[model samples]
Target: MTVTYLLVDGENIDATLGTSILGRRPTPEERPRWDRLLSFARDTWGQPANGLFFLNASNGLPMTFVQALRALGYTPVPLSGTEDQKVVDIAIQRTLDAIADRDDDVMLVSHDGDFLESVEGLLDGERRVGLIAFDEFRNTGFTPLKHRGLQFFDLEHDTHAFNSTLPRLRIIPIEDFDPAQFL
Candidate 1:
């Protein structure tokens, strides 16, 4: 079977879908959904595959968040750049590169449309590229790729019922960390 690689945009995922879980400091509750997402990926794609989360490297992230992701088998990679950082784009490119030499399936979980080109390249290269994002959020924007014959994977909102589920970031204390200045 071809190896599967998951490229996660942690901030994008949290900011876009976290609203569904309304509450203060909902990290604990989000954990179960997070695990479920991973489990879904594993069951759908298989385990022992690469899972990397792209995070803002310049501003630095709380060790707690990093550790939590690590515990879930996600490799947190820091991208170089501050508020002006293009790390997300770079990170996506890196994912494409990693799968260039092998026959692998690429899964990107984010609502960011900036990755359209990179995703197109993956398709052109004959690699299986799947986009995983919130269904509601995805519909809010227009995706030309969708019409251009791109395949996407929508995560079910019923993450709570998944047997292998992880917590979902329903609410985060952005005021404490000051996400605007931090990321």
Candidate 2:
């Protein structure tokens, strides 16, 4: 059976949410529902989802959050590195490289550009590859991959993984915009 490997860069998503979109750190209520993401992955491709959430361990693992992720069926990858090392990105890139050699589909949840090469390697068209992120914050490098069959899904808009609405201002296409949503 084909399984969708869902790789989530926890730090990147948080950073983008805080720095780019919200301009403040996300509160617990604002965080994405990881279980929802896994469910979306399963239903989107009609395959089981293997959710791998990667987080920085420089300050030590957040056990409570890790346990929560575990309860949601995610395998939390806590990575520690030197001051300048981006351990989470490195690990996800390597994992993506390994997945590229396999036959199953994969979905990456991050706005980071570090995995562009690994994602490029997986674009052979033999299986589906998707990027799940806030549409306005995705890396431009992945834009070209859309022509090569790299699917894009908005984490909040498409997946509805958050319990409440996020304050995000993105250019909405006329057909997709709904004024009633604001009313």
Q: Which stretches of candidate 1 lie over 4 Å from their true place?
A: 18-32, 139-149, 158-183
Candidate 2 lDDT over residue span 16-102, tens digit each: 988987899988888898999999999999989999999998889899999999999999999999989999999999999999778
Error of 1 at 128 (Å): 2.2
lDDT of 2 at 35: 94
- Report the lDDT tens digits of candidate 1 across residue range 1-183: 776687887777666545653333335444335555566566765544567877876766777978987898888887767676678777777777767667777777777777766676666536566777755566334366666545666654433322333334433345545566437
* TM-score of decoy 2: 0.97
CA error at residue 148 for candidate 2, angstroms: 0.4
Give all TM-scores, in the order shown: 0.69, 0.97
- Candidate closest to the true structure, highest lDDT: 2
Return model 1's CA RMSD, one decimal. Answer: 10.1
Candidate 2 residue pairs that clash:
none
Tell me the lDDT of candidate 2.
Answer: 0.93
